[model samples]
Target: MSKNLEHQFSMLVREVRKEFVGNGPKEISTRFVGNWAISEMKGNLTNVEKFMISSEQGKQMVHEARTKMVKQIYKKAEVVNKFEALMGAKVLRMFSDINIDEDIAMTVFVFEQSIESKGK
Candidate 1:
């Protein structure tokens, strides 16, 4: 990106970081690889897909993925921090610090609504 864009993105990321930090760590659920599959698994995938592609069951996937993810997260602080910063910004922009999950869901709903409304 251009210097100006990078600066703006950095500022936005900083704002997000502040909100996220202010809310604290335990309350704010961040993904450390394991968290991703833990929070995102559908529990309804086909056996074929799970076995052939994933090479393991959902639980095993969570364990292995989490281990790998945690390692990557620890090794690459800069990239992880940037991702966290973006996530924080997005969460902050969409919801109050008090009710993060609900706010995030509502934000998505609202964005979808806006897109649909615009399409109409």
Candidate 2:
């Protein structure tokens, strides 16, 4: 597990963040374990977006919007190619979720095979 692998994962996250949010988060951190990479996003929302996601209903709405965005983005083969290139592993699945209370989002990327040692 090279730290560079974590950095590559973080870069992939920031790139994807840009697609959905028009810009990357203030910070993106990633950890690799087994066949999974977990990305933590900070400053994931603007002031107005924060207000809109303040309540339970707002949170649900935002969650659904994020889900839709994920689906749409996954349709781009270039995006998938970039992911595989950066990860050095075939992506099996991806999951994204946001916590309005924390103003943070976490995305999990599961690979068909382990990337833990591939980047080393």
Instruction: Name model 1 segments beyond 4 Å from true.
Output: 1-49, 52-62, 87-120
Q: Which ten residues in a row have the lowest lDDT in candidate 1?
A: 105-114
Q: Looking at candidate 1, what is the lDDT of residue 63?
A: 45
- TM-scores for all predictions: 0.22, 0.85
Instruction: Give the per-residue Cα lDDT of candidate 1 at 106.
Output: 10
Write one digit per residue (lDDT tens) for candidate 2, span 56-111.
88888877887677666766778878888887678878888777678788888889
Q: List the residue pairs that clash in candidate 2.
A: none
What C-alpha lDDT does candidate 1 achieve relative to the native structure?
A: 0.29
User: Judged by lDDT, which candidate is best?
Assistant: 2
Angstrom error at residue 24, model 1: 26
> For candidate 1, lDDT tens digit of each residue in 1-120?
333333343344334434432321222221222112011111222243235334435445544443343343334456445534533321111221112112221101011111211111
